[model samples]
Target: MVVAVLLGSVRSDRVGERVAKWVIAELESRGHEAVLVDPMTLKLPLLDRMWKEVKNEKGSEHAELKAKLQPLAELYQRADGFAIVTAEYNHSAPPALVNLIDYFLEEYFYRPSAIVCYSATPFGGVRAAVQLRSLLAEVGMGSIPTLQPVPAAGDALSAEGVPLTQQLAEKSGKFFDEFEWYMRALAAERKRGTPTGTAA
Candidate 1:
């Protein structure tokens, strides 16, 4: 399956990049195609209008907005699943990540997503993951049951973006197993034109 690994932070010293790299490597190692989607690089402008409004507007009236969002929409549409690497900011997710998720609704519909939540503290950004579950659900995306939480993320990864310990590596493996199962199941369901909520 083609999975999109989202680097959900844009801070100068963000550790989410390292987490995202590790996720991509894991997915590739398992023979899955992984694409990196960085909100920082995408640089999507803050949402000024709701998606429904843009859809209802005339072509010329929303041309600029369409241009900015088309690439992102296409990427998400092609992805069978997603792995969002996020950090908790003030007990919530970063606004940039939220903005990226808000850019398209239909692209995320019926797709499955996994969460890799990391933080400097022991909680490992679980709050952000919890909030993201709700947001992704609203967009008709199902989340894998196993959430990968890396506490003290800066220490959990090596400078080369590899897992620093066997325990961490094992946790990642289990998470990927669950993620892949959902990805394949949902991808098949989507292909067979089966209804969204009918899958196991």
Candidate 2:
């Protein structure tokens, strides 16, 4: 199975990269294909009127957004599941992730997604996870109920851009287990032409 990781932090602290790499490694160790989807690596604007124009005007190009979209959507179409690792900004996920998720609708449908949220404060932006789960379901993605939240996150992060506790390592295993259950179930339900719960 292929698992695509959507990393949410844009900080140079490398929190997103670190978490993505580790998660991909863990997934790979278990014989699954895990990939990191870094928003930073792609040339995307924070807010571009281009995307707004393209969707409205016939034959207009979403050149800026398409660079990221075409590639990601292709990968997304083939993936079995996804892991979105993001740091909260002002009690919510980064705007980058919000936009990224919004760019595509149907490509993410009928797939499993899990969240790994972190923040400087307590609860590790678990509240955002709730809202994020809502959004994922709205976009036709099945969200895994089990999630990882690293609280007091700044204290646990070192200067070299590493997590101090690595608590997410353990949670990832459980997340993957649930993903397997949900992915298999969703595939079966699709074939059976029956709908299941929005959240798994």
Best-fitting candidate, scored by lDDT: 1
Give TM-scores for every candidate, taking all chains together and pairing residue i with residue i. 0.88, 0.78
- Which pairs of residues collide in candidate 1? none
Candidate 1 TM-score, true structure as reference = 0.88
Q: What would the per-residue lDDT of candidate 2 be over residues 6-69, giving only the tens digit for each residue?
A: 8887677645565566667767777888877877786467655433344445443665566556
CA displacement after TM-score superposition, residue 77 of candidate 1 (Å): 1.5
List candidate 1 stretches off by more than 4 Å.
50-65, 194-200
Clashes per candidate (backbone, < 3 Å): 0, 0
Cand. 1 Cα-lDDT: 0.83
Q: What are the lDDT figures for the candidates, one per model?
A: 0.83, 0.71
- Model 2: clashing residue pairs? none
lDDT, model 2, position 95:
81
Model 1 clashing-pair count: 0
